[model samples]
Structure formats: structure tokens, C-alpha cells
Target chain A: MRVLGIDPGLTRCGVGVVDVEPNRTAKLVDVVVLRSPADLDTPNRLVRIADGLEAIIDEHRPQAVALERVFARSDVSTIMGTAQISGVAMLLAARRRLPVALHTPSEVKAAITGYGRADKAQVGAMVARILGLEAVPKPADAADALALAICHAWRTGGVAGAAVTDASAPAPLARTTTPAQQAWLAAERSAAVSGAARRLKK
Target chain B: MRVLGIDPGLTRCGVGVVDVEPNRTAKLVDVVVLRSPADLDTPNRLVRIADGLEAIIDEHRPQAVALERVFARSDVSTIMGTAQISGVAMLLAARRRLPVALHTPSEVKAAITGYGRADKAQVGAMVARILGLEAVPKPADAADALALAICHAWRTGGVAGAAVTDASAPAPLARTTTPAQQAWLAAERSAAVSGAARRLKK
Candidate 1:
């Protein structure tokens, strides 16, 4: 399947398209950086971001959207900018009803750099080397975005091809509760812990 | 080819292995969560994380490791924790001499959700549904990890299968660049702009 990976930002959004096959070899289709000035007002910037996202999607028409999962509390400005950028992407994906998946930054870095904490440069270099390229990708943001795409392609291809061994373990989903339910349970657990601590102290 | 996606954290690391085929379908071979409690010292945690990673790799034997890219502020404490977790992942992959790729969170979310701003629950729900599961996956982290694998599978499959349309486009290697180069360019640009501004004022 063709996976379209995007690194969302209000000012410098990056998009990458990658193709994967059964043998685990991956090819880079298209990778580009789309940027806007940070000075632009929120609404206009968002619109521009949306337009940029739509253009990439229209051009690529990928079967699925492989996006990076957001981390909260990165700072208000950063978070807001990221959220705006992310919003544009989701709007387009939902418009097309395309399935979407989100991955964390560490996950993407670990997949590409062999080090979860590898900086952008390491990731860029590793992405180039992994694909058997001679030079590291340019514009760190774009390279990072491409790395995201490559990671998705590799992991998804492995899963889809059934190459991973099951190890005869039961599925985790079998006994797990949904997020909403888990939240409720978590509250109860905390309350109980507090109660026990109070009783002991008294 | 089998792709392994790892979502690294100090406490719980989520790992997923997926196999992709020529026709663009993914089959889950294995998914697991590794836990290293905060009660353990940093070194012990690192050891635990490393051991868990090695064990997973040994069982799965993925051709490539796709990790999420982490970008943290210069804050000492946060950076240290991130570094340790990332270091373990890197050590594991490097020990095996396996190729690795890193991607930012925005990129992964965009790839999967077509919107960089997708919420965790939304991402989890979509991942489950895309894999043809009955409901959303639990422990948001695990689902995100799985999604990362799925994204990699799709992108790389297209590349390896020669499905990409733009042969003229830069290959994956073209974008990777060292941070020093980027810094130098930024400085140069700033100087040039300052000179231009002076000229304009004159």
C-alpha cells in the first residue's frame, strides 16, 4: 500500500510518500517541504496549511494516512501551532474517509535511527543509509517527515505481510478495556490508594 | 519484509511487528508491551529496557527498526530521561546491525490520520478498524506503536514494488543533512538579510 506521511507544522509542513513490498525493501516516491511564515494570523495560516495538505493528498491519493501522534504539553505556542497543522491534515483525511494511524516521535526515531533519541541529523542520515542512498536528505524537517514515512512503510509492511512470528501468545486486546473505561478504573485506583494511605497515617 | 515499530518510554515501551505483502495488506505477527518501572534506578531501567528490546528483536528478527523521533527542549531532566530511553533502543538495534529509521510524531499522525491534529483516541480507534479489529485498541501508546508499523509497511511497499510515479523526485537519501550544515546556512541567510536591510535603509 502507498503510505503518505506528513510532518505537520503551521510554518513548515513536510510530506512524504513511500511504497513498500513483501521483501521489506522500500522506495521513496515523493518528499517535499511546505512552509508558511509564522507571522501569519492564525486563521489564514491554518487555511494555507489546509490547502497545502489537500494538494499533497490530491497528488498522492494514498490508501492510508500515516501521521505522527502528538505529544501534549510541548508549550502552548508549540502545541497550538501543531494542533492547527494537525487539524488541517485530519480534515482532509476525514473528507476522503481514509483510514489514519498515529505514531509517536520516539517510535519514529527509534525505527529509523536505531536510537530513539537520535537528533534530526542522525535520523536524516540513517534514513538515507537505510534506503541505500549516498547523501543525507536536506531541510531537516523534510528529512524527518520522510523518515516518518519510511518507518510506517517498514512496520506496516512487516505486519501486513505476516512475516512477524506470533510466539503463540494471546492477543492483548482480548482482556483490555477501552480508554474511557480505563480512565474510570484509574480514578478508582487512585482514590483507593489515597484512602489506604490516609488510614495507615492516622 | 518484516517491520518492527517501537514506541519507547521510561515506564512502558510498546512494540509491534507487522508483515506487508505486494498487494498492500498487513498481518499482525506480534505486539507486546515492555515495562520498566520508575522505582528502578536509571541504570537498571536502561538494562531492563535494553533486555526487553533485545528479547523482542530476537524473537521477531525484523529487517528494519522504525522508531518515532523525539524532540525535547534543553531542560536537563526531560532530556536525560529521553536520552536514556532512546539510548537503549539504539543500542538494541545497533547491536543487531539492523537498519533503523526515525520519524516525527506529526509525520506519523499525518500519515495515519491525514491530519496531524488527531487525538489519541481517534488514532487508536482508526488503527483497530484499519486492521479489521472489533474495537479501538487500548493503552493509547500501544495502538500508536502499531499504527507506526502499519504506516511504514505501506510507504516502503510502494517504493520496493516500483509503484512510485515520480522517478525524477529525490530519493530518500537526498534530504538527510547534518545539523551543522543547517546551522551554517541559517547563519549565512541571516547575515545576508541583515546586509540587505542595511542597504534598503540607506
Candidate 2:
């Protein structure tokens, strides 16, 4: 199933799509960041965001869309704009009859990094490693969107995939490797970096 | 000019419409309450609100729409839901290209009651008097919506139809009797009350 995950914001709404096969491996389909500047009037900006989502849905045709369910937030400043973007995502998805799943931020972190408390750096590294990409996605919002896609795939992927297991835990512990693994890891890094550059060009 | 005012909410969205002629005296056109039950999910509720707004626009064909500008409140509980509804209202208005105007709560209060901090009772009484209606519009949200409409008309309307002038401010202060005040006031109360009851039935 192909899933589209959106990290919604008024100025920078990020979208990332991933295809998760029966075997539980996920392939990065595409990622983009859309912006509606603060200076623009609210209605105009909202319409732009909705139009952008329409294009993304038409281009990607994801079977499902995952959004960060808006929570009651004490920080009123960012929540309004964020919720507005989130509202657009929800309305459009419903209009298209696409099944919608809402995941909390902690759920996303746990799914991506096996630690609900994982920081942005940890989530970014895991998104890169799991997707076999060269470097982390640029602009934190993009990485976050990709992370959301990966999270959905892992959480719903059945026995072959899991949300977060203690075994796959934090990255610092994953660093300990055998001598044979050390050399293999170095080679894999160089190949993946070059391959990522070539793939990104497309 | 005809104006539609929206008091946005998740479960209950209130709508009111009024027409102001060249002389500035306003007449109530219609009022309605739209619902998306709490038992229902978020997206479905949002669509219901949008559909209700569409119907209102089609039936009334208001020249302009007024919305309660979403505010940042310390209370986080209902703000997200309220803001989402507000966002939906804005988007629909934009889609129809019906000139959207947002008024803050205090601004609406001040326009109608001549005091930005006027309590609900004062606003309700003033709305009924200003629009030539009988009784307060039920469900505070609906009354609030009507108040919003009156605010827009008075604030932007040409000199003749002002809701309440700063000089003649406050319900009690504006209660001065003209030559025909006693008989006219009595007739107006009886006639308007019965007329309102029949209008509401339809």
C-alpha cells in the first residue's frame, strides 16, 4: 500500500509518500514541501494549500494518508496555523474518500526510532538509514514528513514490521558492531551516498 | 446589502443572515444551527459544516460573509476544534469568492453594544432591538452569529445603518423615548414577536 504522510503547517506543509510492500520493506516514492507565506491573506493561503494537496493526491494516488492528529495545545501561537493546515488535509482526504489515520508525535517518533522520546536528529538518521538514502532529507519539515510515512508503514505492516521494539531501540546502542560489520558498514555508506545523489537527480 | 455571519464550532455551528437597506435599518433574513454530532468523527463533522455553509450561501446569496476570527486563548481544550471549524468556514467563503471578513469577539461586542466588553445579555438585547426581532436568538452561538452580522453592517455600512454609536452607546442609555415611542414600542413588540415566531417556523 502506498501511504501519504503530511506534516502540516501553513507556511511549510510537507508531504511524503512511501510504498510499503507485503514483505514490509518501504520504498521512498516522493517528498515535497509546500509554502503559503505568512503575508498572504488567510483565505488565499488556505486555498493555495488545498490546491497543493489536490495536486499531490492526484500525482501520488496514495491509498491512505496519515496526519498528525491535532491536539489541544497550550502553545496557542503555532497551533492555530498548524491546525488550519491539518484541517485542510482532513477535509480533502475525506472528500476523496481516502482512509485517514492520525498519529501523535510520540507515536511517530516511536515508529521511526524505536524511542518515543527520540530527538529530531535521531528520527532523521533513522529515516535515512531505513530508506537507504545518502543523507537526511533537507529542511526539518521534509524529514518529519518522511518519518511519518515510515511510521505508518512500520506500525501497520504486521508481523514482518513492528512499531518499535526494544531490540531495534535507540541509535547509540545500534552503533556497537562486530569487526566484519565495521568494514561492511563503511562500504555500504559510500555506495548509499553515491546512489542517493544519482536517485535524487531523478 | 446582505451579509451572512458564522459562529464556528465543531459540534454546533451557528449561522445568521441580515439585509441592510440604504437607510441602515436592518432586517433579519434567516438563522440556522448546523450540527455534526460528537459521536461522529472529525472529518465527517467538518464536511457537514461545509455542506451547511454551502446551503446557506445558495439560499441567501449574501454579498459578504463575516466570521469570528479565531483567537489564541489560554484554554486549549476547545480551541483546536473551534479553529478548525473557523478554517473550514474561511475556505468555503474563499471558494465562493464571497468577500470574507473576520471580526474579533470584542469588536463585534463593541459594534453592537457600544462597549467592547459588553456581556452576553447586553449583546443579545441589542441584537434583537437592532434587527427588529423578538426574543434572543437561542443557543448563544446563534445569537453570537447574528451579532457578528450586525457588527459588520454597522462598522462598514454607510452612515445611516450604524448598530450603536459611541455617543448613544449602552442599551439603557439608548432607551430614550421619541414622540411615538410608547405606542410604537408596544406595537412593535407584539407584531415582531408573532412575526418572528412564524418566520422561525419556516
Candidate 3:
């Protein structure tokens, strides 16, 4: 399954695309930060951002979009910009008949780092490890976008029975898990056990 | 000059179009409230609002757009929705090459009612009177949208040198006031004097 993740902002919007396999591995397709100058009027700035987003969508053609859910913050102006760009992203997705899924910051962090309160560096490290990247994507927004994409893919059980797959593909197993799924579950369990051991040692 | 005013909201967006003359008189062209169901997802609801706005613009062919500026308030969610829709409005206007002017709530009130703190009823009454309508536009949003359009027209000195007018039209005078401009200024001064007199009496 191909997922496009967006961390929306007026001045800097982060976009990342990833292809995920049913085996819970992800491959980086593209990642970039879209920026608009501050001196420009709000309307024109939005047009710039919208154009960048449209270009990315047209080039990548992802099956789904994962957007960061905006929340009220201390900086009112910043939050307003975030919300505005997020709305634009969702509108673009809807126009293309693509499904949009909103994920909270903490949800992405937890999905990537196995801890809801994980710091940015931790999430970035996990994302690099998951995608087999040489370095964490530059700029926090880029890494965050990648994390969102990985989170969505993992949460949706990767590409099993996804639309992009063959129509004759069997439905996702209910009681029985595929070998890859079992391995993934076992890896998670091992990680949890090691985390508990570290806490005990502390 | 034809102006399209938008009082943007996610659930019910108010839109009004008016034709304004250099004499400070305005005739209502169209006014309607575009609604999207709350039950619908945000993306779909936004798409619906965008479609409605596009249809109105196509039909009216307004020369400019006047949108209410969003501000932070106690209701964070409401403010977010307002900002989002406002962004959409601006983007639409930009795409059509129509200049967008944003007016704060107090500015709209002051322009329409000669008082910055006028209540909704007072503003609505002024809008209806200015448009020569028998009744105030239904729903506060509709009235507010018209007020925005009228305010923009009045602030920009109406249609004297507007693009919709003939290119050979004379430029707006600086020192020498036109008869209509003088009358409009006199009316504003009279309103100010009366307001002060009333305050003194109180």
C-alpha cells in the first residue's frame, strides 16, 4: 500500500510518501518540505502551498493520505496556519477521491517509537530504522511526515487485502496469522520484554 | 464594483454579492447560506462548501472577494473551522485572479454601523438599510457577509476606478471630493456628531 503523509503548515509543509508491504517493511518513495515565503499575502501563500501539494499528489498518486490532526496550541497564529493548510490538504485528497486519515502527534510517536511520549529524536531514529534509511530525514517536519506514513501503514496492517493488491488476493486472516505477521508480532513482543527489562534494571 | 463577501464557517458559510456605485449606494445581487452537514466528514464537508462557493463565483462573476478575517476565540474548534474555510475562500479567489480583502469583525461593524462594537442586530439592520432591502438578510451569517461586501466597497472608495468600470473612467480625486463622496463623508460626520450628542445626554 502507498500512503502519503503530510505535516501541514503555511510556511513549511512536510510531505512523505512510502510503500509498505504486508510483511511490515516500508520503502521510502519520496520526501520533501514545501515552503512559502512569509512576505506574500495569505491568499497567494495558500496558492503556493496548494500548488506544491497538487504537484506531489499528481506525481506520486498515493492511495491514501495521512495528515496530522491539528490541535489548539499556545501560539494561536501558528495553529491557525496549521489548520488552514491541513484543510487544504484534505480538500485536495477529497478532490482526487482519496481517503484521508488524521492521526494525532502522539499517535504517530507511539506507532513509530513504541512510546506515546517519545521525543522527536526517538521517533526519527525508529523511522530511519524502519525504512532502512542512511540518515534521519532532514528537518523535523520531514522525519515527522515519514513517521506518520509508517504509522498509518502499520496501523492498517500494511498492504494485506489493500486495493492496490491483486483483486483475487485472499482476505486478511482472522484467527491464523501469516508467517510474516507472526514474525512481526513476535518482534514486538520481544521489544516489549526488553523494554520491561531495562525499566527493571533502572 | 461587484464584491463577493464570505462569512466562512464549516457548517454554514454565508455568501453575499453586491454591486456598489461610487455614490456609496449598494444593490444586493445575491445572498445565500451554504450548508454542509455536521455528520459528514470534514474533507467531504469542505468539498461541498468549495463546490458551493465555486458555483456562486461562476454565476455572479464578482470582481473582488471580501472575506471575514478569522481570530482566536474561546471556542478553539469553531475558530479552526472558520480559519480553514477562510483559507478555502482565499484560495478560490486567488485562482480566479480576484483580489481578496480581509476585514476584521470590529472593522466590519465600524464600517457598517459607524461603531466598532455594534451588536449583530445593529449590523444586520445597517446592512439591510444600505442594500435597500425590506427585511434584514436571514441568518446572522448572511447579514454579516453583506456587511463585509458593503464595507469593502465603501472602504475602497466604491466603483469610481474599479476594474469593472470603463477603463477611461477618471481616477478617484484626492483633494477635490465628488458630490457623492462629499455626501457620504457628511453622513459619517453627522452620525459621529449624533453619537456624541446621545452620549452627552446620557
DockQ of each: 0.01, 0.21, 0.32
lDDT per residue, candidate 1, B42-160, as tens digits? 43455566677788789988876766655555553444345345534643564465655555566566555555566686667656755767876667768877877776555454232
By summed lDDT, the worst window of 10 consecutive residues in model 2 chain B runs over: B160-169
DockQ of 3: 0.32
Please provide, for model 3 over A12-126, each residue's C-alpha lDDT reduced to its tens digit, 9 standing for 90 to 100.
Answer: 9999999998777799999999998876777778899999999999999988888887878998778878888888888888889887777778868766776767778777777
Ranking the candidates on lDDT from highest down gives: 3, 2, 1
Best by DockQ: 3
What is the total number of backbone clashes in candidate 2? 1
Predict model 3's lDDT versus the native: 0.78
Indicate the residue-level lDDT of B110 in model 3.
72
Candidate rank order under DockQ: 3, 2, 1
- Please report how far candidate 1 places residue A25 from its true position, in Å: 58
Candidate 1 Cα errors over 4 Å, as ranges: A1-202, B73-79, B158-202
Which candidate tops lDDT? 3
lDDT, candidate 1, A1-202, per-residue tens: 6777888776688888777665656777788888766654343455566667778788988766666655556454565456445534644565575555555687677556545676786777666765667887778777877777776655454332221111111321123335554464345345533553234234
Comparing 1 with 3 on DockQ, the higher-scoring candidate is: 3
Best candidate per TM-score, number?
A: 3
- Any runs in candidate 3 off by more than 4 Å, and if so which? A159-202, B159-202
